[model samples]
Structure formats: C-alpha cells, structure tokens
Target: MNRLYHVALSPFCRKVRLTLAEKKIEVELVEERYWDPSPDFLRRNPAGKVPVLRMDSRLMAESQAICEYLDETLPNPALIPADPEARYEVRRLCFWFDDKFNAEVTRPIMNERVWKKIRKEGYPDSRAVKSGLAAVKFHLDYMGWLLDQRRWLAGDVMTLADFAAAAHLSCLDYISDVDWNRSANVRDWYAKIKSRPAFRSLLADQLPGLPPSPQYALLDF
Candidate 1:
C-alpha cells in the first residue's frame, strides 16, 4: 500500500494529500513528528520534511515533485494543464502560494499558533500572529482579483495551483485564522473546493489538543 508521512496541518503535506485523493490513490496516513526526526525517518528524507511518500518501491520527498509525478502517472483527472502557457501559469501560482504566501503568512501563523504549542517550544507570539493575519488580507485580495478574471487561480480548469492555495488556506481555516468574509470571491472559491470529495480526508483530520474550528469541516461554511 502507498503511505504518506505527514503532519495534520502542514500545507505541503496537505497539497500532496489533495493531489493523491484527486487521483483516487489510496494511501495510509502516518503522522510524523518531523521536528524530532528518527534515524529511519531521516534516511527516508534527509531534508526532514513531513510529506515523505512511500509508493510501491519508490520514496518521494518533495511535495511538488510527488504531486507532479502522481499527475503524470494518473492522467484521467489531470491536475497540471497540457498547454505550456497554461502550465506556466499553474506553476507560477503554485509557487506564489507555497513559497510567497507560506513565507509571509502560513509559516509565521502556524509556527506561532500551532507548532510552538505542539512542540512545547514556547508561548504563542501575538506579534507574529498579528503580522501573519495582516499579511493574509493582502493575499486574499490578490486571490479575489485573480478570481475576478478566471474561473480558477491558474485558469478555467482546476489545477495544482488551486490545491496549493487551498492547502495553505485550509490550514489557517482549521485554526480559524482565515476571515472568509474578507473576500467574497475567495470565500466562494473556497466553499466550492471545500465541498469536493477529494477534501474529505483533510476535513476529517484531528490534531491532539488542537481541534479544528467549527466551520472547518462544514461544507456549507
């Protein structure tokens, strides 16, 4: 059986999970404490990431690579676009979420609000959380602007870019950090994506002592 080593709230892991579910690939979910990696885990991924995937005889490390490989191997519901220009847009948006949005918002917020508590490292830093909250508004507005022109973030068809953006936002949503009312376009987009069959596993995830927000699992929210 295919297996995924992941933390419940990691956007990188969630991106891979979304891609796998979209492809209808069955995978065993294993929650890994990557901050304190074991020897075996380190051997699996020297980078010490949460989303180390073991499929058949292959072990995949990077989230984007794993997702792209899955899309390539299972082409029925293609997540990456075929056209080069369309593909470039998808990749661009994927990086915008995973790299830019993550750095500005997701990491700071999750680190302060979630990981610190989980790891017993320190108290939640209010200033960092506030900064993340402030930064997220800009991102939401940006997404709203994009949605104004296109059906999806990358194009008319749903793609990895949507999943990438959703992955990060979903994590924040779990913590009730996302103000869905801030952008009608983003809220409507999220509602549509959140209702997908591929999103069920993520909606069902429960972290010890850190339950999801009331609306996190609500399809109508």
Candidate 2:
C-alpha cells in the first residue's frame, strides 16, 4: 500500500492528498512532526517536508511533482489538461496559489494563528495576522475574476489548479480565517470542491487540541 507522511493542516500535504483521492488511490496516512524532523523522516525527504509520499517502493517529495506524476501515470481523470496551452494555464495557476498565495497569505496567517499555538511558541502577531487577512481580499477577487470567465479555475474542466487553490483555502477555512462572504464566486466554487467525495477525508481531519471551525465540515455552508 502507498503511504503518505503529512501534517493534518498543511496545504501542501492536503494538495497531494487531494490528488491521490481524486484518482481513487488508497494511501495510509502518517502524521509527521515536520518541525521536529526525525532522522528517519530526513532520510525519506532531505528537505524535511510534511508531504513525503511512499508509493510503489519509491519516495517522492514536492507536492507539484508528485501530483503531476500521478496525473501522467493514472490518466483516467486527468487533472492537467492535454493541450500545451491549457496545461500551461493550469500549471501557472497552481504556482500562483502554491507560491504567491502561500507566501502572501498562508504562511503569515498560519504562522501566527495555527503554528504558534501548536508549537506553544507565543502569542500571535497582530500585525502579521492583519497583513495576511488584508492580503486575502485581493486573492479572493482574483479568484472571483477567474471564476467569472471559466467554469473552473483553469478552464471548463477541473484541474490541479483548482485543487491547489482549494488546498490553501480549505486550510484557512479550518481556522475560520477565510471570509467566504468576500466572493460569491469563490464561495460557490469552494462549495463545489468541498462537496466532492475526495474532500471527505479533509473534512473529517481532527487537529487534536485545535479543532476545526464549525463550518469546516458543513457541506451546505
């Protein structure tokens, strides 16, 4: 069986989990303390990232690489498009969320609201949290604009881009950090993604002392 070492609320980990679930791949989930990486974990991934996938006797790191490899090998429900231009669009949007969105919003907000509490480090920085909160409005508006033009984030069909965006947003939603009221388009798009069978595991995730927001698992919301 395939195995995945991950943290429950890491968007990068969630992205890989989403890809695996979307392709009907069953994987054993192992929670890893990435901040305190064990020697064995480091052996698996020198980078010490949470999402290290062990599949078919192979160890894979990097969510984007693993996801695209799966898309190439599985080929049933294609997450990346066939046309080169469309594929570029999908990859572009995936990076937009994973890189830009992460740096601007997820890292700052999660570092304050979630990680600080989890690590028992200290109180959250209001300025950093406020900055993250302030940044999300622009991201939401960008998503809304994309949704207005296309059925999904990349095109008419759902792609890894959508999963990438959802992965980040879902993590934020777990802590009630996302203002779903900001964009009807984004909210509706998330609702569609959230209701998928692939999303069940994410909705069911329990963060031990840190419980999810009340609406995190609610499909109607």
Candidate 3:
C-alpha cells in the first residue's frame, strides 16, 4: 500500500491527500510531527515537511510535485489540462492559493491561534490574528470574482487549483477563521468541494486541543 506522512491540519498535506484520493489512490495516512523531525523522516525528506508520499518504489516530497507526478503517472482522471496554456493557468492558480494566500492568511492565523498553543511558543498574538481575519475577507472577495468568471479557479474543469485553494480554506474553516458570509459564491463553491467523498478524511480530522468548528463535519453545512 502507498503511504503518506502528514500533519492533520497542514494545507500542503491536505492538498496531496486530496490529489491521491481523487485519483483513487489508496494510501495509509501516518500523522507526523514534522517540526520535531525524526532521523528517518529527515532521510525521506530533507526539508522536514509533513507531506512525504511513499508509492510503489519511490518516495516523493513537495505537495505540488507529488500531485503533478500523480497526474502524469495516473492519467485516467486528469486534473491538469493537456494544452500548455491551460496547464499554465492551473499552475498559476495553484501557486496563487498555496503561496500567496498562505503567506497572506492561513500561516498567520494558524501560527497565532493554533501553532502557538501546540508548540507552547507563547500566547496568541491578537494583532496577527486580526490581520489574518482582515486579509481573509479580501481573499474571499477575490475568490468570488474568479467564481463569477469561471466555474473553477482556472477554468470550467476542477483541477489541482481547486484542491490547493480548498486545502487552505479548509484549515481556516477548521479554526472558524473563515467568514463564509463574505461571499455567497465562494461559500457555494466551498460547499460543493466539501461535499466530495475525497474530503471525508479531512473533515474527520481532530487536532488534540483545537477542535474543529461545529459545522466542520456537517455535510449540509
């Protein structure tokens, strides 16, 4: 069986998990604390990231790379377009969510509200939490704009871009950091994504002290 070493709430791990599930790839999920890295885990991934996938005869690191490799290796249900231009758009949107959105919103809020508590680093920083809250509204509005123009972030087809966006949003939603009311379109889009079978494990995740929002596992929510 394939295996994935992951952190439950980490968006990068979530993205890889979603991709594997979408491809009908059955994997044993092993929760890993990447911050307090083990020597064996470091042997698998020098970067000490939570998402390290072991498949068939090889081990893969980096969420985007792993997803793309799966796309290329298992082409039955394609997540990336064949055309170069279309593929570029998908990659662009994936980066927008994973890099830009993460740096702007998810990391800040998760660090302040969740990671600090987990790491025993210090108390939550109200200023950082406030900034993350403020930034998320802008992101939701931007998502609304994209949804207004295209069925998905890149185009009509659901791609890695959607998974990438959902990964970050789901983490925020777990913490009740996201304001779904900010954009009805974005909310509806999220609901559609959340309803997928591939999202089940993610919705069922329970962090030790940081419980998910009440609506986290509600299918109708």
Candidate 4:
C-alpha cells in the first residue's frame, strides 16, 4: 500500500494529499514529528520535512515533485494543462501559493498558533499572528480579483494551482484564521473545491490536542 508521512495541518502535506485523492490514489496517512527527526524518517527524507511519500517501489520527497509524478502516472482528471503556456501558468500559481503565500502567511500563523503548541516550544507570537492576519486579507482580495476574471486560478480548468492554493487556505481555515466573508468570489471558489470528494479526508483530519474550528468540517461553511 502507498503511504504518506505527514502532519495533519501542514499545507505542503495537504497539497500532496489533495493531489493523490484527486487522482483516486489510496494512501495510508502517518503523522510524523519532523522536528525531532528519527533516523528512519531522516532516511526517508534527509531534508527533515513532513510529507515523505512511499509508493510503488519508490520514495518521494518534495511536494511538487510528488504531485507531478502522481499527475504523470495517474492521468485521469488531469491537474495540469496540456498546453505549454497554460501549464506554465499553473506551475507559476502553484509556486506562488507554496512559496510566497506560505512564507508571507501560512508559516507565520502556523508557527505561532499550531507548531508552538505541538512542539511545546514557547508561546504563540502575537506579532507574527498579527502580521499573518493582515497579510491574508491582501491575498483574499487578490484571489477575488483573479476569480472575477477566470474560472480558476490558472485557467478555466481546476488545476494543481487551485489545489495548492486551497491546501494552504484550508489549513488556515482549520484554525479559524481565514475570513471567508472577505471575498464572495474567493468564498464561492473555495466552496466548490471544498465540496469535492478529494476534500473529504482533509475535512476528517483531527490533530491530537488541536481542535479544529467550528466551520472546519462543515460543508456549508
């Protein structure tokens, strides 16, 4: 059986999970404590990251690489466009969410609110939380602008870009950090994605000692 080493709330892990689910790949989920990296875990991924995937006589590290491999191997309901230009746009958006959005928002908030509690590594940083909260509004407005012009972030089709963006936002939503009402367009886009069969396992995730927000699992939310 395929298996994924992951932390329930990590956006990077969620991206891979979403991709796998979209392609209808069954995988055993194993929560890992990457901070206190074990030898076995390190052997799986020397980078000491969550979301090390073991499948088909192969071990994969890096979320994008794993997702792309899955996309190539399992082509049903393709997440990447065939057109070169369209594919470029999709990849660009994926990087924007995974790198820029993550650095500007996800990491700050998760490090403050969730990671601190899990690692027992001191208290939440109010300053970081405040900055993250402020930054998210800008992202939401930008998303709204994009959705107003396109059916999806990258194009008309729901691609890996949407999954990447939604993965980060969903983690924040679990912590009640996202303000859904900030943009109706963004909210509607998310609602559509959130209602997909691929999203069920994500909604079902329950991190020990960290209660999900009231609306985290609510489809109507």
Candidates in descending TM-score order: 2, 1, 4, 3
* Local lDDT at 17 for model 4: 95
lDDT of each: 0.94, 0.95, 0.91, 0.94
Ranking by lDDT: 2, 1, 4, 3
Tens digits of per-residue lDDT for model 1 on 1-221?
99999998999999999999998999999998888889989999989887999999788999999988998999879999899999999999999999999999999999999999989998998999999999999999999999999989998999999999999999999999999999899999999999999999999999999999999999888
> Ten-residue segment with the worst summed lDDT in candidate 2?
46-55
In model 2, residue pairs whose N, Cα or C atoms come closer than 3 Å (at least 3 residues apart or on different chains), thus clashing, are none
- Could you list the CA RMSD of all candidates, in the order they appear? 0.7, 0.6, 0.9, 0.7
How far residue 217's Cα lies from its native spot in candidate 1, in Å, is: 0.4
Where is model 3 poorest over a 10-residue stretch in terms of lDDT?
175-184
Task: Candidate 3: list runs displaced more than 4 Å.
Answer: none
Which prediction has the highest lDDT against the true structure?
A: 2
Give the distance in Å from residue 169's predicted Cα in candidate 3 to where it truly belongs. Answer: 0.2
**Superposition TM-score, candidate 1 onto the true structure:** 0.99
Model 2: per-residue Cα lDDT over 1-221, one tens digit each = 99999999999999999999999999999999999889999999998787999999999999999999999999879999899999999999999999999999999999999999999999999999999999999999999999999999999999999999999999999999998998999999999999999999999998889999999999988
- How would you encode candidate 3's per-residue C-alpha lDDT over 42-83 as one tens digit per residue? 999998787999998689999999999999999878999899
